[model samples]
Target: MFGMADMDPTGGLWNWAASSSLSGERVQGALAGALERTVISLDAEGMDGAVLCDVYHVSGDFPTLIDVYLAPETIAETTAASAVAVRLEVEIILPDDSLNPTRYVLADPAGGLRHVHVDEVETDDGPERRHVRPCTGDDPACAAAPEDKAA
Candidate 1:
């Protein structure tokens, strides 16, 4: 059962994690069921002619978007995006202990998000400092910068 907080405007986060390899079809199917009402399926063209069926969940009231991609070899394919629905994304452990759905995102006005990094530009009377923050909580692979590291 999902917690009320998990189903609310609270943006759900996920990272590239899994004790065992997960298939793209499995991820897409799971997300489609979890977000059946809001999900929009798409067959996006990828590089090298690799076609990917991506799933996106968008809330009509919020700019929040949940992107579920097919997991490739090694890395799980799925992430959630939100602009201003909440301050921080909450972590939820699914029944499958091997799976990790703790990916998150901060508000991005510039819309610079690549992989698991969010481009954060800060100008405080000095040289413009542009650093990358991880979209998720704490994955050594997708670790956030020291300044943005969670407590």
Candidate 2:
């Protein structure tokens, strides 16, 4: 089950938790259902097309917190423009594990979903920087785009 803890014009955060006896597949289905419900609610409130920015387990426990970051997209040229930084996090978790957590799932305006992973690499300047890339075979629920699948 899940519940929304906070919400605002910019975004919202929700918490999801399931029983330990539940299978990983069931957990995934529940998570997807929660996301779908959230989208519907947001759309009803005129906040459609909000992008999911982060998902992480709370304190390495059962309840997971998901952060959805929303920003208005300009369909035409406007006076002011703003930028938002997106960071995706990736870590290994078994598919059969009941608490499977994903870093981020981006929902585009075209209704396309992109799963991405973020890695930190050490640069020449001796600083670690995050690099985001598409989800690989190891990731759970990772799938190719519709066009790619058709080809």
For model 2, residues 1-151, the per-residue Cα lDDT tens digits are: 0101121322333222211223333333333343443222222445346433334332222223333344223210010000011111112211111122333333322323344443323344221223435666554544433433464
RMSD of each: 16.1, 16.5
Please, what is the whole-model Cα lDDT of each candidate in the order they appear?
Answer: 0.29, 0.29
Pairs that clash in candidate 1: 13-102, 13-103, 14-101, 14-102, 14-103
- Per residue, candidate 1 scores C-alpha lDDT tens digits across 1-151 of 1122123222333322211223445544444443332333355334442323442222121212233333223222222222111112222111112122222223232322233332222234211112334445456545544444348
Model 1, residue 39: displacement in angstroms? 5.0
Error of 1 at 73 (Å): 28
Candidate 1: regions farther than 4 A off:
1-16, 38-42, 45-151
Q: What is the TM-score of each predicted model, taking all chains together?
A: 0.23, 0.22
Clashing pairs in 2: none
- The number of residue pairs in model 2 that clash at the backbone is 0
Instruction: Kindly provide the TM-score of model 2 when superposed on the true structure, using C-alpha atoms.
Output: 0.22
Model 2 per-residue lDDT at 60: 29
- After superposing candidate 2 on the true structure, give the runs of residues whose Cα lies further than 4 Å from its correct spot: 1-12, 15-102, 120-129, 138-151
